[model samples]
Target: MIINKILNVDDYYYDVFMAISGTLTGFSANELQSTGLAETYYKHILGQIETATFLEFLNVSKSILENSFSQDQLRNAIQSEIMADPGMQDMSNNIITMWYLGTWEGTYVNELSYKESLVWNVMHAHPPGAKQPGFKSWAVQPVNSNS
Candidate 1:
């Protein structure tokens, strides 16, 4: 239920999370809940918006979702809003980073497996310590994933 509240979806919190995350962080939330990462993310978000209330963030998320803004629009608006509300912006980016990195920056109670991380897709590279293609792989070339 809290997941739905976060994404402002009526049902299928995973799908809603997938959409919001894909839109917000450019990562998929598929299987994230099964790994318990979704719950951890929800807690992190709830903590970030605890100042006024979870409902405050929910109201904002609901408003944003109702508009069906494009990902760029959502990102730009959030980027601008960070000036006015830095904490929420940091929290939002942290959420995105969680989707991206599969880990939070600071200490947290929940455990995460870096092996399950998603940033590899964004970066178009191999995970650290996972493998080495060969000597000088980095020197030769790497695809420009962002482009």
Candidate 2:
């Protein structure tokens, strides 16, 4: 149930990602990668969830990251969120799978094998080239999504 709630929050984040990119015309792959929107979008989701005490509902100990949420649980939450949207359902497995691989093998994996590779590959390929305008740190840090 807590994962479900988290998934709902992630779904909102995904929607925001789609909305931001959808409005762009001739949005080159480089531009998409350089925009660093996914990182911003994820942080926005975490902020909303934290502000709403969504994690508190899970009763996870704040001291430990692994104990707070197992990798499988996180994967399921992401998959569930992706599948709930018509536009994302078809790509849910690819998205979740890539995130899994990226987390485990490092985002620099040279042999990615999923459509979601496009997503992570782009992020990895064009990491935050310069400091993001409003944020204090680079957007594409390794721990961005894990938290």
Candidate 3:
């Protein structure tokens, strides 16, 4: 399985890659652990790295999946980019987490009530719960936005 293959890799970069990929693809850790796609994805990620930078690999992967770039083309691009920026070899879990958040739109979360948000926040930060604390105690107010 892809998740197993990724988990087996001792490198932190591979771990971060798997995390980001799972987040982007909406695959839970359990799902990834059970499926073959995780390994396929990991191998694809390995093929994309030349100088072995996490960010470059992520950029290439994002372009391939999000912008519809071909896997081979994206891999080559990442290889050259990594060669030029050798300092990008490390991966930051926080950065990957943020990337995952930005990539995954939270339409449902935004519509949640304050109480719901609290419940969801306790279970998971994303997809905030629909009810808010003291929902019955507060008056509903409207705010203006330029958008």
Candidate 4:
């Protein structure tokens, strides 16, 4: 007889969230953790959505991450499994927006998240007025300014 394994989302909900966020945002888990806002984002998401629905989303995300082997496969799995569901779409979009823009539901999550937002890095700039680059550092060119 074969025993089916149960998906224990509560055992690894945050891990699943990070993996899903990385996949959704095209960033790695390490990058997301480096922001120091993973816990904040996780709690925010939990507070925004219902417990049962959040657990279900975590379970689906866990399955997709497990079954996907390559980036292409991951994208396909996400498109079919997560993006296909209206509820999951909202959660996924929020996760992507939070990672890239440091906001959720069109509002800034916090000052920390805004400071460490990924969109600035993607655009090869820092968040305006967040990180001062020293006195007159703009005289020369930025170190990573070259495309």
Candidate 5:
């Protein structure tokens, strides 16, 4: 089905994208938006997938958002509706990888993507060369963040 026939891409596509992304990544929409790569990643994913497939993914995302009530329900819906679909597997993997590693298809999307990669946050560290702590800061033992 042609996407534009039923849904307006220019209006709510990104919102749906963010919602689905947040569910898939276990991050809040606010945290994902804080990276400043929402638009960048949205456009990038759109470019990477066939329009028909991408639209279906968006529709499923919207459905998942509207129907899911709790965390388990959301995750189950994603696993069944999104991950189980053969057509969506590559794109689903890409979204997760993109959010965590800041790469699409194993390549960095951009410098900003690298700088703001979620992996660094998960590790409680900064991306190397993206942010400088200070001269000789690394020489000092890093504090145990988990303590």
Candidate 6:
């Protein structure tokens, strides 16, 4: 049950998390796995959040995504789930933030933490001000880097 220990979900629901999170954040499941979301966020940050809210968020999110296909359907299911439980919006946002930013504030309701963000990896681009490789070198194609 190490997978459950790590992801806080049964083995079967692992794919559910992958699908919902990937569709919601527009990242591939492989991309998420590459960044170690289960170890960093699920076991650490999510484990520290309000247990009921976090668990409910997972349960409801999985339920919503179960019978859905396409990005739009996934979005709708998440929206419906959020409507059913307003607090889950915060949970959903935090999850997305965790994937893209690689850190969670435990419901502080603030901007995402991009210090160790996976977005930089997903985008195959630099974070502009953070830590750009070979500064002003113009070697890598700048997605948002200003000259």
Best model per lDDT: 5
User: Which pairs, if any, clash in model 2?
Assistant: none
List lDDT for all candidates, in order: 0.54, 0.35, 0.42, 0.80, 0.81, 0.62
Q: In candidate 6, residue 19 scores what lDDT?
A: 60
Candidate 6 residue-wise lDDT, 84-139, digit = tens: 56687777777787777666664422233354467787677666776666756666
Model 6 TM-score on a 0 to 1 scale: 0.66
lDDT for predicted candidate 5 compared with the true structure: 0.81
Q: Is candidate 4 or candidate 6 better by lDDT?
A: 4
Q: How does each model score on TM-score?
A: 0.55, 0.19, 0.31, 0.84, 0.83, 0.66
The true-structure Cα RMSD of candidate 1 reads: 6.2
Put down candidate 2 lDDT per residue, 75-114, tens digits, no spaces: 4544444445554443333233333332222342233222
Any idea what lDDT model 3 has?
0.42
Q: Model 6: runs farther than 4 Å from truth?
A: 1-15, 106-116, 122-124, 127-137, 140-147
Q: Which regions of candidate 5 deviate over 4 angstroms?
A: 1-10, 135-147
Each candidate's clash count: 0, 0, 13, 0, 0, 0
Q: What residue runs in model 3 are displaced by over 4 Å at the alpha carbon?
A: 1-6, 48-147
Ranking by lDDT: 5, 4, 6, 1, 3, 2
Question: Which pairs clash in model 5?
Answer: none
lDDT of 5 by residue, 13-51 (tens): 887888778777888778998998988998988887787
Alpha carbon deviation, residue 112, candidate 2 (Å): 18
lDDT of candidate 4 over 103-146, digit per residue (tens)? 98988898898899999778877777888657877796866668
lDDT tens digits, residues 11-95, model 3? 6555656654554445555555453344444554355445445456665544443443454754455455433454532332322
